[model samples]
Target chain A: MCGIVGLHLRDPALYPRLGELLTGMLCEMSERGADSAGVAVYGDPVWSPPGHATVTVIGAVPDLPDVTVISLGETHVVHAPVPVDALVAAIRAQLPDALIAGFGEELTVLKGVGHPRELAATFGLAKAQGWQGVGHTRMATESAVTPEGAHPYAVGPDQCLVHNGSFANHATIRRHLTARGVVFDSENDTEVGARYVASALADGRDIESALKSLCAEFDGFYTLLVSNRDSFAVVRDAIACKPAVIAETDAWVAMASEYRALVGLPGIEQARIYEPEPERIYAWTR
Target chain B: MDSMTIVMDKGVNRTLHRLDAGSVTITEPNGKHSVAVGLNAPLQVSIEGHCGYYAAGMNQLADVVINGNAGVGVAENMMSGSVRVNGNASQSAGATAHGGLLVITGDAAARCGISMKGVDIVVGGSIGHMSAFMAQAGRLVVRGDAGEALGDSIYEARLYVRGKVASLGADCIAKDMRDEHHAELRSLLAKAGYDDDPADYTRYGSARQLYHFHAGNEY
Candidate 1:
């Protein structure tokens, strides 16, 4: 079980209101899953820090330095201008189990084993600025509960996603995606959708076509929500074994696992809420 | 009489949500199987709309009322209490009835009262085929036509149909309806608001012949 929420604000000025609504939705939807929570907000800055953050890890620090290497054996210092590959290699060299998932120019993702509340405190999620994104709260039914199992998983540059349901042909799909240089870090079926969609787009398939192709190939229950800096998409599986509510107004479009979360939103009374039809796609831009 | 209320969804019936307190009025609110299966309360329930499948199975102490068409097994294993249907009833109206009363205001489908033990069943319309297959006890009084195999393997149960008897059960024959039976049939008809003539019927029962299931049984 998991809860996924997405919002595409047609009105750019409602950043604060959207943030409040998004937070409330995440907390409320957390009831479906309490393993982890993360949101990728678009176009709004909680407190703009930098265009990029360099989280450096030093190997076996014999001595502590006051410089950027202020952290001990393994450190996650949100520094600027650090190379991505060098940082990943350094962290992997020290802690081979290290996983570095990044998003957008400024917003970064850091997850570990804990509840949403605890992870939020550790990741300083409240301080992360808004970018177009999807949020996830995991229940860990088929997948393990670790940082790798956490979601809003980056499928591409500045891309993240959350999903509910299992893929019937997960192993076969994973094999096909693995052959295309798509990395598989977790055993979550939702991640297979992400990898396939991301690989399709990287091969010049547009987001719409990529999503359609993914649905055509995959079978089972799913309500997938994905977002990047420019676009967001929500797809209902063929059977609709999971629940997804879509509430839309001229100003904003919101998706949540249930209507109760949306009811607490600021403009909910003005929107129309409904269940997404089977095998349907709902996407928006800017 | 206490009461019970139940809410139903479409295509779902056979539900008798617990009864508590005096006579209850159940508003169907559009659902099927709203009241059925093992009603054991000492209350009364009045369903407001159509019901589906086993409206009152194994009814013990509660009185049941269906305002619309009843699906299969309207009152299957009634042990006590009373079931009154305002509309037509489907097959197995009171199969294996042990006690209590089943009153149908309109027509009844096949197997109106099969294997009746001790309960009394009253139907206001025509009964269909294979009714009262192997009745062991109780009485079935029909105010209308009866189809073929009216009482296929009759035992000790008594049957009275107000119309033509298409057939009969093994070692079974028609008997004369006495004064006491007339009084009881009239009371049941009156309860379901029927005013049909009771004289144009025939009574059927076992001769205690095949109650032991003879090896060489014949139709």
Candidate 2:
């Protein structure tokens, strides 16, 4: 089981309160799964800057002196370590968005293995501000508990995906992706989902079609929250055994495993709240 | 006049934990999961907004009224009392519930009353597929159409539908509505606050042929 929280802001007035609101949303779901946690924040100028590229590595950085290394919002960052030649190859491999941190034009993915609340505090999420944010609290069922196993698997450029249930056919799909030369970082099932979306986007598939393809490819119960540079989307399996709730107001669009995570948002009382339909993709763009 | 009012903005666990036998008002429910779970008192819970999964689960003698939409499995495994949803409800509206009167003013989605054991469910609008599967006893009244596989693998439970049924599950068949059935249906409709005549509905029940296995039956 896992808990996922995401916010797509519509009103610029609430931008400054992004981190604080997301922090409250994330912490309210700590009871769902406390094992590990991760988050992906978009539009943070200091973390990703406007032009220069960024990447988030799992462990200590490798020896590369030309790239400047910096840390922001408690998330470790290093300037583009990929040799110009390797960067293309890395993209070809469909590297995860969480692992790379900086994706596309701007994104910052921070992940850690610990209680969600503690990790959120350590990552300084209470003060981070962004146009979009996605957080996850994990309880390992198909994989081991490690930093790499934590979620917000943003494999696509400026894209992030967090899942609440297991995929039964991930191993088979992983094999297919591997045959097509998609190298994976962890054995986690959610990573397979992330890679699937990244692969689709790499081939120029739009977010809606990419998710529809996922509904046709992967099998199992799942409620997935996916976000990119311009859009936030949600989907569920055919049976929709997993739980998910979505609320949208003129100011923002929010989703979580349960409704408690959404109580902190502004205008929640007036928001249009509903559960996403099974096998249907619901996407909102900034 | 009032027992206590609990606000459920933070989470459902703490608010439901403090409920007692009195009039309780829940404000800003915001679709929180498991609201008013496992209540065993003669309490009245009025949820001011939409609520998430398992609202009033395992309830006994509690009257739960959701002012907005209700998520999945509302009144799950409820033993007694009533659960009323003013808006639409998601899947498994009264899954495995033992006894209670669950009324949904709007439509109820898939698997409504699945595995129901002696619970009475009244839906003002349509109900989705596989409803009342393995229902041991009780009545299900739908004012609108029923989806595919209605009452699949059903047991002694009674089903009444005022509109079309897309399909019926194995061993479930339509039965003639007698005077007693009309009276019972009238009472159920009255309890659910619908003024429609019970004679407009059709009754369905298990065929009883599936009770014993045949030598070459495909089943």
Candidate 3:
């Protein structure tokens, strides 16, 4: 089992407290998964500065000649005044063995193999300021408990996906994608799901359509929260064995594996809270 | 009878267990799992806020109420007594329960009474897909609509739905609502504090087609 939490702000007044709110939500779900944790922050000025592309590498890349590198615990954030594709290519060429955790124009992904609360402190997540954030705590059902196996798989440009349930037909789908030349980063089943959604989004389908395609092709129990620079979407499988609760107020929209993670949000008492129905896509946009 | 308030923390269930008879109010539940499970004595318990998984599991001779929403398996494997949820319930609300009356005033997610041996579940709002899958015995009554594949592979347990049924599951067929079935539905609804008419309901039960294996039904 795993835990997934995400926050999308509708009121700009709450932007400064994004990380603080998300940290509480993430830590409350520590009991769901304690093996590893990962988080993705969107529109953070310090983490993803304007007009500068960012690529997060999992391990130490001692020699990346001409880029600003910021080390946060186990992951390294590399910033350069170039396009996202160019920076990713450069990092891949220089550090052949380095794993590119995330890459986007307005996103920063940090991951580690440890307790979520400790990792949140190490990453200074409470001090982060952003418009959107997504976090995951994994119990390692499909892959090993390594930094590379953590979730919030940011495959496409500025897109991130986190899952709470395992995929039953991921191996078959992975072979299908592999036959079509889609390279994978890890053996984790969630990565396969992320890659599939990323490919669908690349083909110009909207987030809702992409997730619908995923539900059609993939067979499993899953509650997915996929986000990009502008949109946040949540979807569950047909059976919907995995639980998800969504609470929305005029100021923000939040989702988690359980309602406890959302009790700390502002105006929670008055918020419209409900569980997302099976096979339905609930999406919010900036 | 003594009345006291207890803030939920570690050993809260044990504290509730120690009480032989009293009215206890649980505050700040904060979605904690197994809040008042395994009760053997007659007690009146009320949870003021939302609860996590299995709030009153294995309850017997206790009347527990949740003022807010309940997470998965609210009263799983209950042997006796009553549990009520004022708000919605997640999946498997009364799974594998042998005896009791579980009431949900709001919608219940998937698998409302899975494998229920002999319990009575009444939902005020809709229920999600695959509810009452393989239910052995008991009665499940829904005031609102039922989702896809309701009562799949069901056994002796009777189902009464007042609203639209998206579809029926395999081996679960609609039966004529006899006078006795109507009386049973009315009693169950009254027990759940609903005024809905039993005449507006439909009954469903197992077809007994899959009870024994046959080569003709093989895939």
Candidate 4:
């Protein structure tokens, strides 16, 4: 079992409170999964400055040749004036064994192996300001209880995926992706799903179609919350055993595994709240 | 018969369990699991906000009202009395319940009344897929539509759906709504405080095909 929460803001005025609200949602779900936690924040100026490429890595990579590295708790953020591909290649050459938590133009991913609340405090998540944020608390069902096994697996540029249930056919799909030369970071099932969606998105499929393809191919119960630079989407398996509730208002769109994670949101009493149906992709594009 | 208000916190269920007969109000439920659960007294509970899993589970001789939405397995394994949800209910509403009436005024998510033994569930809005799976005995009344695979492998349970049924499960077929069924449905609707016409519904039950093992049946 895992806890997944995401917030996509529509009004620019609410962006400053994005992290504060997301922290509350994430902490509320700590009871669902308390072993490890991760988060992906989009449009954070301090973490991922505009007009610069940023890559978040978790390892002992003290100094890179050209880029600036800032340490935030257990994860490290690398910023370079070069493009994303260049920075990624340079980082790969320098820290070959380092795990790239996230890499994008406007996204920064932070994850660790600890209680979600403590990790949030260590990362100073409440002070973060972003337009979109997705947080996950992991119970270590498919993988070990380490930072590497934590969720919000950002496999693609500016894309993040968090899952609440296991994938039964992940090994088969992992083999399929491996045959097509998709290197994996961990043995986690959610990584396989993230990699599949990333590959589909790379193949020019939209977020909705990519998730629909996932529903068609993957087997097992799942409630997935995926986000990119411009869109936030949610989908469930055909059976939809995993729980997911979504609430939307004019200012923002929020999703969590339970309703308690959403109680502290602004205008929540007036929000249109409902559970996402099985195998139906609900996407909100900015 | 004293009236009191209890803010939800740890060990609150124990306090509630100690109450024999009183009117208790639970505020700030905050989606906590097992709220007001396992009540055996003649008490009245009113939860002021949304609840998490198994809210009012194993209820007996209590009238519990949730003013907000209920999470998974609301009123599961209920013995007697009634549980009412003013908002939508999450998955497996009244699952494995033996008796009592469960009223969901809004839509119920997947697997409503799954494996129900003898509960009476009334859903004011639609129910999601795989509802009433392996139901041994019960009465389920859905005022709105039902999702796919309703009453799969059901046994003896009567289903009354007022609106569309996406598909019926295996061995579950539509039956003629007789006069007795209309009367029963009318009584059920009245109990659940609904005024819908009984003739607007269709009854479904097991065809008994899976009841007996057949040599030709493939695994």
Candidate 5:
């Protein structure tokens, strides 16, 4: 079992409170999954500065003086003044073995092994400002209990995906994707799900069609929360064994594995709360 | 009547652990998972807000009510007692429940009452596709429309639908509405706070075909 929480702010005024609210939501899910926690914050200016590309590399890295480096434990964020391709080349040349979990123009994915509350604090999430954030607390069913196995597996540009249950045909799909030259970072089943969405979006499929394709191809239980630069979406499998709830207000759209993760949001009582229908795509845009 | 109220925050164990016996009122439920599970004492639990998965799983001798929407598995494997969802319920609303009265005031999503053994489920609104799949024994009453593939692979369990049925599952055939069924459905509707005439409903059950799979049987 794992816990996934996401918040997409429709009002610009609520951006500053994104991290604080998300931290509470993640911490509340500590009991559901205690092994590790991860989060992807969108539109964090310092982490993903305007016009610059950002890369999230797992583990410590030798500082490249030209880029702005922010270290949170072993996780490192390199915000380069140049485009994303240039940053990718520099990282490949400097630290070839460093696992780049995600690189994007508007997202910064940070993760670590510990209680979600402490990880949120260590990553400076409370101070981070973003229009959207997605977090996960993983119990490590499909893969090892490593930080890389933890979720908010942001594989594609400005894309983030977190999952709560196991995928049955992930290995088969993984082999299929690998044959097609999609390099993977971890053995986690959720990583396969993220790669599938990334590949779908890369192929020019819209969010709804990509999610529908996921329902057609994958098997087993899953409740997925996916976020991109301008959209937030959620979808469940046919069985929908995993739990997910969504609450939408004029200011924001929030989703969590359970209701407790959502209760802390401001004006929650006024929000239109409901569970996403199984095999149905619920997507919202900025 | 005197009632004990427990305020639940993020912790689920603590909230359920406190309900030893008697009437209980739970406020600020905040969608915690597995609330009020395995309760043997006769009691009534009123959750003031939304709830998460398995809100009253494996319950016994208790009536649990949710004021807002419920996540998946609202009353999974319930042995006895009743669960009332004031708002909508997600998939598997009464999955594998053995004995219970589960009432959903709002719609129930896909696979509601899946694998139900002996529970009685009544939905105020529509139920999604493939509901009551592989149900062994129970009674499902849908006041509103039922989605595609209702009561697939159904066993002795009886299904009653007031609105249109999108389709019936394998071996599940619509039967004539009998007088005895109307009396039973009327009692269930009354228990679920509905006074609709049971005569307006249709009855469905397993055809006893495909009980034992022959070679090349189409599932």
Candidate 6:
């Protein structure tokens, strides 16, 4: 069992408030699973891989983009949080041929292993300031925990997804995704779903249509939270083995594993909160 | 009686204090479990909200009151006293009990009072499947309909039904509610706070013909 929280705000200047909002929700969501935490943020220019350029995301970040081979994880992050354009340029510098194609906005993904507080610190997640951030706390029933095991997993640079509950027929689904050149990283059902979704949308399918296809094809108990630059989506599998609640207002939309987490947010008193029905897909504008 | 109040939260973990004949009321904001377990004395406990499984199991004390619905096995093995549920109860409400009384105000799910010794369970609503399965002793009173295989292998315990009996267990048969039986029903109902007339119910028990079973005697 794990818990996921996704927040979308109409106000981006209020992005700094996410440090507090995500931290609070992660605390309560810790009950679902306490192993790890992670979050993905959408800023101003969405980074896209160059169509013909050689795209190689080293396991760590490195020094020079074309000549030097950076380990898959270590890229020089801007210590002082800068504006959206600078952040996007810093990201593009990593992959010389990468362009701003899909999400015409800046995005930040921070995740790591350990408890929510611990992982949040390791990745400097709560230190981040942005709007429309999604986070997850893992319990580690199906997948083993590792640096790659933390959630809000990025299927690609833009597509990130988190989930709760067992995903049945994972082996069969994994085989298909791998065949489609969607690389599998951690041995998690959610990772398979994330990769499949990103590849599908990249292959020219709308977000809703791709998600519906995944729902129709996959069998399991899951409440999935997915997001990109301009929008967010939520879908639950046929059987609701896990619980997910959403609190919405004109000001913002926040989702968590339980009702207690939504107790006192801005507009919370006037917010309409509800548990998402089993097997329904809900997508909204960012 | 003014029972002692123990405010329990995350700070209190493992090893619940037993209460014997002592009256206590619990207002658990966390909605915890094992409130009053493994007690030897006759204590009465009133839980304010929904309780997790096994509320007053293996009781040797007095009565307990659950203000809300109970999870599985409200009284697992009752040695004595009584357990009263103000709301519904889940499967195996009283399984393998030797003594005491269990009163459920609402419906009870499957397998209520399986393998009874000398206890009495009174449910005001319908019971789910496999209730009274292998009940050895005591009495089960259901005011509503019984599900499939009502008493799979019933023993000497008496079963009273106010509604339809879908099916009966092995060695069990619908019995005539004689004068002595009616008096027993009246006493129990009165004790459980039921003001309904006695004649509305029917009693079911072992034919006693299977008290010493032969393979040929079972159906």
State how far residue B75 of model 2 sits from its true place (Å): 1.8
- lDDT score at residue B80, model 3, on the 0-100 scale: 93
Q: Which of 1 and 6 is ahead in lDDT? A: 6
Ranked by TM-score, the better of candidates 1 and 6 is 6
Per-residue lDDT over B1-219 for candidate 4, one digit per residue giving the tens place of the 0 to 100 score: 598998999888999899889899999998889999999998999999899999999999999999999999999999999999999999999999999999999999999999999999999999999999999998999999999999999999999999999999999999999999999999999999998999999999999999788988767
lDDT of each: 0.67, 0.84, 0.93, 0.94, 0.89, 0.70
Give the top-scoring candidate (lDDT).
Answer: 4
Runs in model 5 deviating more than 4 A are: B9-22, B77-80, B212-219
Instruction: State every prediction's TM-score relative to the real structure.
Output: 0.53, 0.87, 0.97, 0.98, 0.91, 0.55
The C-alpha stretches of model 1 lying farther than 4 A from their native spots are A17-19, A43-50, A53-96, A121-131, B1-219
Q: Could you give the CAPRI-style class of model 6?
A: incorrect
Candidate 5 local lDDT, B1-219, one digit each (tens)? 458777875554464556656677888777767777777667788888887778888888888888888888899999999999999998889999999899999999889989999999999999988999998999999999998899999999999999999899999999998789989999999999999999899999999886787778676
Window of ten residues with lowest summed lDDT in model 3 chain A? A58-67
| Minimal lDDT window, size 10, model 5 chain A | A237-246
Instruction: Judge the docking of candidate 1 as incorrect, acceptable, medium or high.
Output: incorrect
List the DockQ of the predictions in order.
0.02, 0.55, 0.73, 0.86, 0.61, 0.07
lDDT: the better of candidates 2 and 4: 4
Say what the interface RMSD of candidate 6 is. Answer: 6.9
lDDT for model 3:
0.93
Predicted candidate 6 versus true structure: per-residue lDDT over A1-286, tens digit per residue: 7888888887666676776777767766776788777666665122112221112231344454332221213322222233334444555666554322212234556566667776665545555566677888888877777656667667554667888877788889899878876666678877778878888888888888989988898888788998876778888865444656677988888887654455546767567655454456788876
Q: What DockQ does candidate 4 score?
A: 0.86
Q: What are the per-residue Cα lDDT tens digits for candidate 4 across A1-286?
A: 8899999999999999988998999999998899999999998888888988999998787767777788877689998888999999889988899999999999999998999999999888999998999999998888888778998899999999999999999999999999999999999999999999999999999998999899999998799999998999999989988899999999999999999899999999889989999989999999
Reference-based TM-score, model 1: 0.53
Chain B TM-score of predicted candidate 5 relative to the true chain B: 0.93
Tell me the tens digit of each residue's lDDT in model 2 across B1-219.
466666785555465556566688888776677888888777888888888789888989889899988888999999999999998888999999999899999888778999899999999999877888887899999999998789888999999999999899988899999999999999999999998988899999999888899878775
